[model samples]
Target chain A: MGLIQRVIEAAGIATIGISIVREYAEQVQPPRTVFLKWPFGHPVGEPHNRAQQRAVVEESLRLLYEIDTPGTIVDLPFAWRRHDYSAWDQPAS
Target chain B: MGISRWKNQLLALLATRFPALAKKFTDSYTPRASTGDIPWVRPAVPLHRAKLALVTTAGIHHPEQQPFDMQDANGDPSYRAVDGDRLFDNFTITHDYYNHSDAGKDPNIIFPLDRLKELVAEGKLGSLAATHYSFMGHIDGQHIDTLIRKTAVEIAEKLRQDQVDIVLLTPG
Candidate 1:
């Protein structure tokens, strides 16, 4: 996934990836990423959890604009199935 | 299903249930290391004004499309062009490297197209690209080169042609 991100970014389009494995992101070094210590299949969040999914997408998109350094992986604070996503306010720009 | 597919499915299930086992599995496969400068592109527009697209390595495709090649141990590096507007009408997942039962129920967890649409409606996002891309995330060995040189580049060109300003990638 990080590999594809690199190719796309190299083509001049901004990219942000949601990575479940930090090690792979560290190795492939995609331009921007947000890491979640979640399970292998769930990158955004749990199934049917709209708020959680929205939070992940919002934070990731926000970082795409804010991250100036290449290969920066922001460790997301949301815990798998535990974080209170309903309270997640969209981060200030 | 072939024995390799069955084995991979079992491993995926086990890994999803056990984080320690998941770590071991990820540790077993080393992605190609970064050798040179990493690629970088700053966003050209704000969230509410940029055109967004999704690219996922989650093995999702239209049911009529060819399923990913699961018989190969190295994994398939090809991609599926997903129609963002009609994907939820019917879809299929062909990845054995991860248990996708939950994703099968609500693919928004991996693809999140529905959530993105909601964002567009609420004016938090600008719009979505008509076409998105999907690939199985288990590519390894020689297929990695094919992905980096061929398939990924093709998708990037397509995104460029579409005038996409930003992309959000997801994994499975």
Candidate 2:
């Protein structure tokens, strides 16, 4: 994604990334990146977690605004605690 | 268990069972971190309503592009392109590495184009470009980077030509 961002930026357009793996994405460092501590696949917080998801979207947008230089990453301190819910194991009704 | 903790336990077990594997994981582990700056000059005016596109690296191959090569299956670096149809139906991910607990969900489990389109309809995005893109992530580092860069360039060019504003990369 950072690589893509670089290419997009080099083409003279603003670019950013939403990295599932925050730490790894930071190393690649696109012009702008939103970091979610949530595990892979659930990048925008999680399903049914609309508030957190919106917050993530907002934070991601803010990254575009708050970035002073390229390759900026804003870490949103949201964690996915699937263990809190045992219903995950039950079959869907 | 937390994924991180599970990873630790898995690593420990691997070490206990296969010392060599443990050494390998320990040596190759790259901790994630936010570091470095990407050199970019924002558009003259930041894109207020940017169209978004998605790209995936899930080794999804269309029957036409190239059949999944079992010979190259084990350690093949090159990846095939999956036709953007119902190709994802009955999707079976084959990679010896990485945990497969998330497999068998929705093929979109890897590439969620429908979800993106949903957001587009809800006006979360200005527009969803007609075409979405994908690539197999398994490849030689040089080839992977080259192919990814080439694809990104093409996508960016086409999007720019089509007046696209943003691209959201979904790496599975």
Candidate 3:
């Protein structure tokens, strides 16, 4: 993802990323990033939680201009609502 | 630091130094990339006025196109273009590494096109590019090189052609 982000950036488009794992994001070092504690495959936020999802996306794009320097990661301390995770609770296929 | 912390650091250093200890680390580890000279071009327009594009490595594709190859031992490095304005309810996930239960429920959990459009409407953003992208994130080894060198460049061209000012990469 970072590789592609850099490619687009080099083409003169600014880029920002939302990362669930700090390790990978730190490795490639995108132009801007928002690190979230969301689970894998849920980078924006939970399904159906429109407000939280929209907020995460908004903040990530906000980082593109808000960041003064390249390769900056805005680590966001976000917590997933502790509901009975329906996905995990699903009957196994 | 505490004595226990010092011991753990020492062990980590030894693992990097000695093959014997490295083999016993018992987890995935990668040497970090040197990014001193990474390319970055800031938008001339503020994010609120710039056209936004969303890209994901979540192995999602429109139901019409072919799915990513889950059987490839080297992993699939291919990418698909998703029509941003089109209804994306039929989009599906095809990767093997990460669990897709939630994404399967609502792909906005991974792709978030709906949320992005809302942002655009609310004036929190400018506009959505006509095209967004999807690639399989589990690509590894030589396949990953192909992804970076070939597909990434190709997509960059598409984004450039679309006049995208900024992109949001959502990785699952």
Candidate 4:
């Protein structure tokens, strides 16, 4: 997270970040952030689940609304599925 | 700071110092390239609370372009080229491993444009960019360095053209 924040920061852009695990990001402090409870990969939602994806996007955007003060952080209301492997990792046959 | 923390730190030292094939191993953990500690090589557009864009690297294939070869994806798909200008109105999520793929490859996992539209309805954001971006997720940096940088430029240009204020990378 530090390296990415550095790269994005170096690009001269202010960034807002979201992460399932945000301890490292919190320590490093990107410009802004939103914390999510989902697993590492499905930050938005499950694969092929467009509706859930939209919800995630909406929540992430809301984070931008509060960025005016700078260094603002928000916690999202969404939760992650408990089951493992709702989809497959290997390419389909 | 704690006993467990110290133990974990010791383990990391031992692993790095006395791995079975220490010579064969390289310090693969690279930070994003930088001339120094300045961070990004180029500046991203200022993110205002306005219309935003989403980009994904889930190996999404447009109906018009060649489909992602599963066989190739399993191994040396690093040679594949990114077609940044291509428009993909229709796409499908391929593997479930997007949570673990590189940001450049499976961007959609992080930036879900389809979801952004819904948020607009819910008043979470102002709007979505007219067009989003996608690319192959499995390319090796060595093989696709030029393509990745070019695509970033192209994406930034597109976002600027679209008047997007923010880009949300979801990585799911």
Structural similarity to truth (TM-score) of each candidate: 0.97, 0.62, 0.82, 0.52
In CAPRI terms, where does candidate 2 land? acceptable
Ranking by TM-score: 1, 3, 2, 4
lDDT of 3 by residue, A1-93 (tens): 776787788878888888877777688887888997666667877777766676677667667778878888888756666533333232212
lDDT of 4 by residue, A36-82 (tens): 75554555655565445555554565554455543445777665544
Once fitted onto the true fold, the runs of candidate 2 whose alpha carbons sit more than 4 angstroms away are: A40-62, A82-93, B1-37, B41-48, B60-97, B100-104, B107-112, B138-140
Per-candidate clashes, comma-separated: 0, 8, 0, 23
lDDT of 1 by residue, A1-93 (tens): 999999999999999999999999999999999999999889988898888988999899888999999999999999877788876545323
Using TM-score as the measure, name the better of candidate 1 and candidate 2.
1
Among incorrect, acceptable, medium and high, the docking class of model 1 is medium
Query: For model 3 chain A, where is the 10-residue window of minimal lDDT?
Result: A84-93
For model 3 the TM-score comes to 0.82
With a 3 Å backbone cut-off (N, CA, C), the pairs that clash in candidate 3 are none
Best candidate, lDDT: 1
Model 4 has a DockQ score of: 0.18
Candidate 4 deviant stretches above 4 angstroms: A1-17, A20-37, A47-55, A67-93, B1-49, B67-90, B94-96, B99-111, B122-124, B138-140
**Candidate 4 residues B32-87, lDDT tens each?**
33233333222233223466555444445445556544343221232112333343
Ten-residue stretch with the least lDDT total in model 2 chain A = A84-93
Flag the better candidate by DockQ, 3 or 4.
3
